[model samples]
Target: MTIAMPVLRPKSPHFSSGPCAKRPGWSPKKLNTSVLGRSHRSKEGKARLKLAIDLTREVLQVPADYLIGIVPASDTGAVEMAMWSMLGERGVDILAWESFGEGWANDALKQLKLDDVRVIDAPYGRLPKLKQVDGVARDVIFTWNGTTSGVRVPNADFIAADRQGVVICDATSAAFAQALDWPKLDVVTYSWQKVLGGEAAHGMLILSPRAVKRLETYKPSWPLPKIFRLTSGGKLIAGIFQGETINTPSMLAVEDYIDALEWAKGIGGLPALMKRADGNLRVLNRWVTATPWVEFLAVDKKTRSNTSVCLTISDQAVVALGAEGQAAFAKAMVARLEKEGVAFDIGHYRDAPPGLRIWCGATVQSRDLKALTPWLDWAFALTRAEFCKVAA
Candidate 1:
């Protein structure tokens, strides 16, 4: 008889959808008191802000011409700020495939109150037609990666070369973990929690020269909240764009982010980070392929995300159990895996179809994900026994 190897959960208990795992040895306690709830207007805050910007550029390889700044309310606030500041004047095209992108699309239509809005959406794990987007000559709001659906836009080359409108990309899950086609992206925003394994509630906003020009030239009709305001009198508040947040930020979180950035730099920077995520996905890829009961949720090979790998069990498997039985079986499978510590938080997002969404972020080691498959099989067998008992 063979004994199964013991599973090792990371020294941390975080595979959270947001507020992802921190770099191996990061600590908030090490931050200087100057970073601890200092007035955003204070000189101390500016220094911390400068470090974040500098290291973000070093690790992420953001262009020198671009501006990186602290923004409130995580990725949501950052995207809304850009939408409120830059949309409306141009005919807007919103592309949504997954839950977060859907949230943004709803905000553009219902909250931003834009009449010229065109929404192009797809079901989970699929891309909205690129032709549909390129066909229209409008400013675009799209998520570079659909975290909830496990789908991603493979390339931005489909965007019209001489398009008149700006391309705004929400790259929260894609940044740091994947290579971005920055030249084609006019405005980009990412939060530290998803890929960098840092604290949440703050977001990074990157603006290309063209996006800065839009901020300086155009103003949306909506009232700007103190948190969302990006410009002063139709001109970019370049200081806020530098590091001065609109309001105070927890220095502890900033320090944690700084540590993540430094760790990223030491690990061969973006290229290495991307390699880690791809490696994890490859582990998942083998599991999805070898397990007959399972398959990838994303149909297109090119669009399958290396970051969030979602999976669905086949209808045959579902039919083997009744509705309640199916729900219980799925729950038991995830619970069993979590209890064993081989995997946690594999359950799909609430709005997503019933399945598993495993975050294959840089912090997740590939071997850990590979080990998860056997646990999944074990749990499924256990659940299958439950269904069979009723039949007996």
Candidate 2:
């Protein structure tokens, strides 16, 4: 049996989960207004930085009282700043369902070495028991979307409205594409390079009023790195939230982000962005429903991620190869697709189950996903045949 290769290909063959595809019609020309070669503290540079902050608040609909700041490093720096400054005041509960979430957990237990910490974790494809989280006494840290496992917390209902502890969220992959419950979270972190398709090395940290209070009242026992310092004396750094970044930022990347924010607004803000990601997922859903060769990695429909849509080979013959062989087969299929110019960077995360992880973020076009599916079928068939011959 043979599957004919599709003559059509994705108009843009980028499906990487990070440093994702730029917005439709994006290019270096769009960044001409960048305040290059100017001090970020200068009036012109500060205005551009302020515009980025203002646009983020407007587009994300962040609560009126919450503060947003541009920080050094990507989302990792943002998350670490929140943890180091705020966690020692209270007992902490860390949750992990995938690599990024797990990374935060390791930071809490190993690096920070908080004594009164409880970790709730689940394997790659499933979420931990949300009901088990101790909202009454312990601050909580978790990822809203697990980029590697293609799973996400369904909603914020599990968070108690009267929770005594702060909730810090690493939403690098979830922010613009998913609706976040601002009141439920005390600290939230994301990077420009994820859903918005902007350049990397800058992180956005959003702080609720409670998070700010924590910063003002409690200082960590550890020495704060210059990059991670969020407070001055006994008060919050008001300037940080008002375009005064802790460190220098790339004016070129700032311009790129401003461009992306404008694109997001032009397309109707967060709802439109979510619709784009959802539409990409629906396209993959239709393909998965009809195709017997693959299935979603996240078994639970409600928890399946609309952004990082992961899939595993389900054909009986492919399943028989076991984990290592199946990983090799998936790599071969990915390479073939890349060679054909249909898709790139579709392979699963290195530590995840062997499968494909396709970025279905707001910047990805549904039509491109449609064009890529048949190519996936063709690649799978070609790779499967190669494996069978070796076995024979």
lDDT, residue 383, model 1 = 63
Per-residue lDDT for 1-392 in model 1, tens only?
23344464444444555666666666666545555755756787778778988999889999999988889889888888888888987788889999888888898889888888888999986899987885237898899988888899999876766777788999999998878888888889989898888888998889988889888888777788888788887778878877777887877788888878888888899999999989888888887777877878898989998887888767475756665566666777788777866666777777777677788899876666665667776666666656556321
- What's model 2's lDDT at 52? 97
Q: Give a tens-digit lDDT track for model 2, residues 169-224.
A: 99999999999988899999999998999999999999998888888988889999
TM agreement with the true structure for every prediction = 0.92, 0.98
Q: How displaced is residue 81 in candidate 1, in Å?
A: 0.7
| Model 2: ten consecutive residues of lowest lDDT | 383-392
lDDT per model vs. reference: 0.80, 0.91
Where does candidate 1 stray beyond 4 Å?
1-14, 27-34, 319-328, 388-392
